[model samples]
Target: MTGGHSGRQAYTGVPRWLYALAVLAALVVVLPLAAMVARVNWANFIPLVTSAPALAALGLSLRTAAASTALCIVLGVPLAVVLARGRFPLLGLLRSLVLLPLVLPPVVGGIALLYTFGRQGLLGSTLEVLGLQIAFSTAAVVLAQTFVALPFLVVSLEGALRTGGQRYEAVAATLGASPGTVFRRVTLPLVLPGLASGAVLSFARSLGEFGATLTFAGSLQGVTRTLPLEIYLQRETDPDAAVALSLVLVAVAVAVVALAYRRPGGRGPDGKAGKQASGERPTTAAAPGGALT
Candidate 1:
């Protein structure tokens, strides 16, 4: 049977103080956002958000976020696949290194990117010699976003892969399917929901990126300024417009996450298809021992 019924009972043993703490934690996050919403000038919300500069910033943010999300999928999928399936020395260290961006401060990441791609920097000098400039440009915005957002996709996809296991893949290989065929037809389909969720999260993160974009991309209107950058700039001049834009961003992020996670046909949070909804237990492949591997 599914844990939906049992899960409620399992939580009954929790101490009452834990619930109080949880509420306090929730309030800490919710109060600020509520206050920001309250500060928004509803009378001019539409005009504030639709101003020429606001429109340009919003458009650029969307474009760069989309591009960054695409780059994450393209580069992160292979990295996740290797991380999940490959066996190698120092693999754990490698995984930690790959995920470093997730924990590193955004400004530090921007500095790293600047050194790697800035003119007179590592690869930046080579590119400059070839008549290409990256730092302080729109491309830098996308790159900075991808640098910070890639780890989200990797972590999500890698976790999904680890949980889903490799039984189906092994079976496909035993049946004479080539590695490529099995990956395309079986592996990819199985992890698609996870990939979709990761992409949405990456997009949301990209939309909200600020420190790195400002540090590296240099917020030129209609060129590199994103919504977050716009909001930061507006905070100094027009707090009302800033509040309105912040609310817009918060709404979009909430909608994107909720829409992505809303599974159909009784699918559960685990991304299984209808099994949990039907009160069926999710399957797990056992290891050589009786316990889970």
Candidate 2:
């Protein structure tokens, strides 16, 4: 028996207010983006980008954002796995704490970082003993970006992990697969869509990071003046350049997110493929949770 249509079901009983709210939300973002796009000096866009300061800031932003995203992948994945599968008594609290950065004001986060890593701060003396400094440096920008962007990766991966559950992993273990093998062959593939989406988002967040970077890394050209900081400096003297830089950032972020997010909706080598590869009927795991006893 085939359903009449296997695609999107038309919304029939939706409230009109919901539509109104959706439009409002769309406008909230769209209006600002539209205004920025309209304000861009397209004719001078190339020169603006190639300008020494612009180039330096853009390059720094790209490198720091990439470094931050990479750091997120390294640290966030384990955190996600733990959050997804652990049965600790304080698991919920742990998750809340991990996600705290998302809600914390960026400036406050910068201040927190300053106190924790500043030359005269907590670990400062210890680092000083090692002759390594972190405060007001390129490293600080990377750290600030990583701190702010980590929650995005962790939350996305956790949700995907939860949605994926541990059924495939259990089956692999039952079939004599080692934990490492199951994780590499089963777990990683299952949550890849989320991973990609999260990475893109984190990169976007890192690219736009301003508050924390400014508070922690000070705007030193060629050292830590990332795109946003550069734009801020330019805005007062050259509004056109600022507008152009904003447009460039928005374009890149939009493109990256669109590409990564599009993968989830497509039938591809993603979560469902793992189940098919294992020749098992799908299980409704429902959440990243502790293994079945």
lDDT of 1 by residue, 59-173 (tens): 9999999999999999999999999999999999989999998899999999999999999789999999999999999999999999999999999899878877887778666
**Residue range 1-293, candidate 2, lDDT tens digits:** 24758445554688999999999999998998998888888888999978999989999999999999999999999999999988979999999999999999999999999999998889977898899889889999999999999999998889888877777788767766667767777788778777877888899999999999999999999998999999999999999999888888888889877765563333432333344434564333322343322
Q: Give the TM-score (vs. native) of candidate 2.
A: 0.86
- Lowest-lDDT window of 10 residues in candidate 2? 284-293
Error of 1 at 119 (Å): 0.5
TM-score of each: 0.88, 0.86
Candidate 1 wrongly placed segments (more than 4 Å):
1-15, 274-293
Model 1 local distance difference test score: 0.86
